[model samples]
Each structure stands twice: as structure tokens, then as C-alpha cells.
Target: MTISLRSRHRWFSALQQLAQSIPYPLRGLLLGLLLWSTLTSAWINPDPVWQAFAPESAIAALGKLLFNGTLWPHIGASLQRVAVGLLAAIAVGVPVGLLFGLVPMIERSASGALQFIRMISPLSWMPIAVMAFGIGDLPVYFLLAIAAVWPILLSTSSGTAAVNHKLLLLARSLCATRSETIRRIVIPAIVPQILVGVRLAIGTIWIVLVPAEMLGVSSGLGYFILDTRDRIAYNELTAVLLAIGIIGCALDWSLQFLQKYWQPSR
Candidate 1:
């Protein structure tokens, strides 16, 4: 039993060392490749239908898309929409959240209506958005913004409410103006929480952006996805799906890095 335990410990330690030796990005890439290989191995078959989904074909399609420069515009369009939507959400949500946190009476009165609206999925607003804004980027922007706003609003409010009372008292005692107090004391203290909300909002916006692009937009990754499907280009579709995953992962990692950088020292 002692020998078995020792051997197990040695094996775990070896794996730990091996994992540690790889750079962080390389480790993620290696793990992704491993998973991809496993999925290909399990799903590939001799059937003609399955041939469309072969990993080799998808990889070739990805390479072709990159080499031919057909993918850049779509990527750019999607990124633009995400940026616009996220900015809008932040602009509206942050101020509203601050108001709610500072004035409890107002928050209490509006909570019911806010909760009701929030409970509705942003996707469900697609028809209304289209009707109101027409078939263009406007509707897509609206949907993405709606989807992203809830997280930012809630996170900012929570962070504001959790602010140190003593710090606020000290600022008051120092005769700090309201704007100065907010700028110096509240904003910096709540930055980490705001970043967390932004991270969550990015994830939500990305997810909604894909489907929202289907709303008569001529360009975007979402449109590309539909185009591939309409053309029956399964390999290209797979490649686009892979691209989406990679892009989303990259965005999330960036936000994670930002959050860590802004996190308050213990």
C-alpha cells in the first residue's frame, strides 16, 4: 500500500511539473488540440455525410478562408457590433447602477419593473427591435445591448452597495464634493467589479451577436455562418464555428487579464 501510494504521488507530481513547464497560452492550445483530436477520432466515419465534417476538410477550409482574406471583413463587422453594444450598455448601466446604489428609495421603487424586464430574454426582443429599427445593424445593436446591460447594471450596483461606509464617511468629513467623492473614492474601488460585469457582458453580447447578425445584415460572422449553411458548405461552417470559439476565448482571456490587473490588493 505504501509503495502504491508513493508511485501515485510520483505520477501526479510528474504531471504537475509537465503542465507547469508549458507556457500558459501554449498549454491552452495543446489542450484544445487534444480535445479536437479526440472529437474527430470519435465522430469521423466512412459515411459520405460524415465526410463533410472530417477534421482535415474543416482545417483546409479554415486555411482557405484565412489565405483568401474572405474572413476578415466578417470578423471586423462582428467586432464592431460587439464594441458598439458593449459601450452602449456601459454608458446606460453604470450611471443607472450608481443611482440605484446611492439612492435606495429609488432602487426599491424600480426594482419590480426592472426585474420583470430583465427576466425576458434579449433574443425575444428581436421582432420588436426589427420592427422599430428596421432590418439593419440597428436592431442587432439593440439586441446585443439589451443582452449585455443586465450584468453590468447588477454588478455595478452590487459593488457600489458593498463600498466601505467608513471610507465614504471620511470623504464626507473631508468635505469632498459629490462628484469628487464618486470620481476618487467610488470609481476606483468599484473598478474590479465593473470589469467583472464587463467580462460577463462581453460573453453575453458575443453569444447574442451571432444570432442577431441574421437580422438582414449583409456582413458579419453570423451572416457568414448562415451563408455557409445555405451553400451547404459544411466544412466552412465547421471552420467558422471553430473561429467563433477561438475569438470568444480570446476576448474572455483579455477581460480576465484586465480584471486581475485591476483587482485590489489584500
Candidate 2:
């Protein structure tokens, strides 16, 4: 018993020390990495990553042409797909989450089905998406939805199920209706978990977007990557790659910021 107690105490002490040692400015460090990737790439001779940095003035001119000039249209197309898919997922996920979370019968019925679908790869659905939706925006959006939805749905369900029993008891003591209990007691308690799911889904969809966009879409960073490859515009390719990374990191940071502000106790 003494040995077990000593081990447990040591483990907790280590965790507390590690957590406390984390730098306050870690977020700033991560942001700086995204912003400075363009400046820190290794020399790959004959590649644009090096050539693109010609003169600062020349680099600025080219980057301006690439991003402000040609990139916006691509960005817009990608955003459209991402927005539609993510919105659809949220719509579908939140309600399903509520059902499974609030209704044990629903949860029991879904156990195997949810596990099966979640286990299936979103990329594996590519053939099906293409066959059903064909080669345009529909396929792209389909891919995004498949890639992103499960995390949100699963997390929301878990959050709903795990809501503080004390809060529920308090609501009952106040004679709260089921709807009122869910709205007032449950929603606030679960929002943080739901936000985490949102963050996870965003990460999933963002990573998938480029490859999905490369599906012969005229505009999107995915297309831009393909176009650069075919044109041997390696510098342009690298720049777009950098842009995607920076944008994804920024999106995640934004989500984190929202999570922190929305739940200070978290």
C-alpha cells in the first residue's frame, strides 16, 4: 500500500511539474513558425523555393502576383467546398449527437453502425463520390463531409453523455423541463467538448481539401499545387504549400482562442 501510494504521488507530481514547465508563449512560437516557413526553407537548387527568394522586392512582386492575383479564386473555391461540407456536418452531427447523448435507445441502436462508418476511410469514398457526384464541386464537398463529420458527432455524443450529474440534479430541483434542462444545464456544459470536436473536424477537412480540390477543379490550392507541378513552378508550389500550412495553423489557433474565451474554466 505504501509503495502504491508513493508511485501514484510521484506520477502526479511529475505531471504537475511538466504542465507547469510549459512556456506561456508556446502559441506565439507556433504562430511564428507558420509565418517564417518561407524564410527558413533549405536550399534546393533548381527549385523555386530558393529562386522565389530572389530579391526581397522580386519575391514580394511574385508572391503578390501568386496570392493576390491568382490565389484568391482558388481560395474562394476551396472555401466554398469546406464551408458547405462543414456546415452540413455540423447540422447532421449536432442533432445526432443530441439523440445518442440523450437517448440510450438511440445510442444502443447506433453502436455497431457508427463504429462501422467511422472506421471507413473518407478517401475510400472517393470512387463512390466520383461515381455518384461526378467530377466537380459536389465530389469535393462530399469528400469534405465524409472526412469531417465523425469527430464532431462522436465528440458531441460523448460530451452529452458525460454531462455533470450535479448540474442535472440542480436543474431537476428547480423543476426544469427536459428542454430547459438540456438548453440551460447541458448545452453550456458540453460546448467546450463540442468545440474540441469542431477543432478536430476542421483539421481533418483542411488536410483533405487540397487533395480533394485536385480532382480537376479549376480553382483551389489543390489545383494550384497540380498546376505548379505541371508548369514546373516549384517555387509557386512551395509557396502554396506554405500558404496551406499557415492557413490551417491559423484556423486551429482561432478555434483554440474561441474555446479558451468561451470557457475560461477550461
The prediction achieving the highest TM-score against the true structure is 1
Candidates' RMSD to native: 4.5, 10.8
Candidate 2 Cα deviation (angstroms), residue 83 = 1.7
Where does model 2 exceed 4 Å of error? 1-62, 66-68, 264-266
Error of 1 at 194 (Å): 0.3
Query: How much is the lDDT of residue 201 in candidate 2?
Result: 96
Q: What is the TM-score of each candidate against the true structure?
A: 0.87, 0.76
Clashes of each: 0, 1
Q: Each model's C-alpha lDDT?
A: 0.91, 0.82
Q: Report the C-alpha lDDT of model 1 over 1-266, residue by residue, as the tens digit.
A: 99999999999999999989999989888887776655555355545655566567788898899899999899999999999999999999999988888888988999999999999999999999999999999999999999999999989998998899999999999999999989888888888888999999999999998999999999999999999999999989988988898899999999999987775642
